[model samples]
Target chain A: MASAREMRLRIKSVKNISQVTRALETVSASKVRKAINAVTATRAYATKAWQVLRHVAEQPGRDSLHPLLAQRKSVNNTLVVVITGDRGLAGAYNSNVIRFVSQRFDSNAVPVKYIAVGRKGRDLMLRRGKKVIAEFSNLPAAPTFGDVSTIGRLAVDEFSKGAADEVYLVYTDFVNMGRQITTVKKLLPLELEGEGLVEDFGNKSTGPTAAYEYEPDMRVILDEIIPRFTALQVYQAILESQASEHAARMIAMRNATDNAKELVGALQLAYNKVRQQGITNDILDIVGGAEALSAK
Target chain B: MTIRCEIISQDRTVFTGDVDIVVLPGAAGEMGILPKHAPVLTTLKYGVVKIRKGGKEEIFAVAGGVAEVQPDIVTILADRGSENIQDIDLERAEAAKKRAEEYLAKSAPADTDHYLIMEAALRRANLRLDVVRRYRKSGMRIPPSDN
Candidate 1:
């Protein structure tokens, strides 16, 4: 049993920790709201872009339309754009993504390179001796499309130049406030098939089948739209990852605060017990002395 | 009959309403569409998008994007845009243009990505400034000339 003084110190420390975690929880709560709003706001654009890409991909002889849509015969190297939170304390938010990537790709036959989008992922990859081609950290809280298009461009360039045969994006998908699932998406070769498309774009049966006229021409429009579509995908992924990070942090801090409160409660009870025992012992000693004096 | 026009930027949907006609800066040139027109999908350029309903006209400055025109619905997906002309800060646009220009002048052209991005930024800034100068209400203050 800890002494009363030690218990007092422990309670104080626990109270202080709870205060810090409460503050953090409040901050992350506000941030998560904004991040989720950002995610939802851009969802319209992402879905539209995906729909257009699918329509264009459905056209015949589309494989030769653009390099982005062309699949390589033999994938010699892979580029994994791993997105994680810059700072930790998000309750496995960063570790979950990193671990998922490692577990999925450690035994991959082809060489895998990385383009780390956050400090936590970059550091972990470096520590693990992974080949990190590029690292972008400390993105703005509400990053604009321009802020993340560079990563998309790099992936595009790598794919076109034959540096990376395939590109994969690893991110946490913000399903809702309570749920975040780590998702691995194929970014390059623009997978228009069943698996890569996010199922959240509900009711796939209503896809536009109208044969529309292409201005300037289909080839030129495809050239321009495909690249922007790729960038939009990356931007959307980053938004999802950011929202997930904030939500995870908010929940994690809330739990920490609760745990600290419980610890303080338990410690206070023990401290009170010790103090009362001391008081009882003091009373007993005083009563004994008085009785002895009275007898003498 | 009116066409439903929706201009969506990266962040939000700028405009979604029924319009009599829409004039967009297509890759080839400026093209205007009326209600019940044939479906057309074209890439947009850096210019103003004009939407007219009844007697009033609403203008949007779009950077670069794609415009999908249907018989009843038209969707303009802008790379960056704002429907409200007042949102275009003249000083900010000018400053961004100057910065992009300076960077373009300094950096080697070998880095195509950065050069192209800056180039697009410069074009977008120029388009914003041009749109504000040309389409903004007369009651609004004018931008200062670069001496």
Candidate 2:
């Protein structure tokens, strides 16, 4: 039972909070739109890419040329690259991804390395004193493929040099307008989709029939394709995570604003009731005093 | 019958429409396709992809990627944007070419900031220069460098 004065102050504070949340909600909504546009524009190409690669993946021993496609003899060391937002207030976006990744590792002795792309992720990993291989932050909203180049190069270098046997990417995957979930995908040693690596002529059986007589060989062609493929996917995933973050934040802020408004309305009603009761008491006391004077 | 073609890039979908024939600079060699063509897939080299849609003819410089053709649909997944012949500035492309040559001269891998970009630039310049050299398709040589 808060006094009228206290309730008045609380209502004022709640009003201010709702206004702030509402503003954030609007801002994030616009950003989400931009991010989604960027992603959607590239989706057609990505799908085509998937189809092309699926065709190639069906080929026999095609994976042999691409080292990125080459599976290691042993999974001695594993490195995970986690990407999360730098700022908070995006609902469970950052927390969900971070928590999921932490669960995956579950131990420091796994010989894991961290490549953090966002300030928030870098800070969290630094605090934990984990082995951070590379850290990049201050990315523009809806970054391009060029932005992912340096990081991609570093990862390729490490994998090629035998510093890491397996690499994984942890980021939030965009489902739709209102739903996003943390996605963990393997980066290194391309996973074969079909049956026996021997019988598996890659994802395509007939293969590209345009009659490609390579200048060097199919090996060199595949060599470049494999790393480029991995890097491109990573870049696409980063774009997805960014778009998801904005969408999540926009939705979260909208909910927060709605809750704050509801709370403010309830508090206002209580404050009004308390104030009216106090006024009624004062009027009754005045009437009693007048009645006593009349009796005298 | 005209076949549907989409010349897509990273930033956006550059062109999409029906074309009578599409010539691709395949990694193996120059390959051409007409409507009802066989299902063919091949890696594209950095060169010109000429398109003929009705009476209109155009040229596009495609970077490395895979191209797939299904009975009616011909899709090109290019690594870089296909800057058209009409849209290029010779001076800028020449400068870019010089920069790319300088970059290529460097022995270090880290120094090659964008191997694909330089390659694409070089291809685009060559495409523009070649188109300009040709008396036909002068409409494509309009120098849309500013855009």
Which numbered prediction scores highest in TM-score against the true structure? 1
Q: Note the Cα lDDT for every prediction shown.
A: 0.84, 0.73
What tens digits encode model 1's per-residue C-alpha lDDT throughout B82-129? 555767889999999999989988866745888887888888888889
How high is each candidate's TM-score? 0.79, 0.78
How many angstroms is residue A183 displaced in model 2 relative to the true structure, after the best TM-score fit? 1.7
* C-alpha DockQ of every model: 0.45, 0.26
Runs in model 1 lying further than 4 Å from the true structure: A107-109, A126-129, A193-206, A210-213, A217-219, A293-296, B1-4, B17-23, B30-39, B46-61, B70-73, B84-147
CAPRI-style class, candidate 1: acceptable
Q: What is the per-residue lDDT of model 1 for residues A53-125, given as tens digits with 9 covering 90 to 100?
A: 7666655665776778888889999999999989999998999998999898999999999999999999998
- Candidate 2, residue B5: lDDT: 77
For model 2, the docking class works out as: acceptable
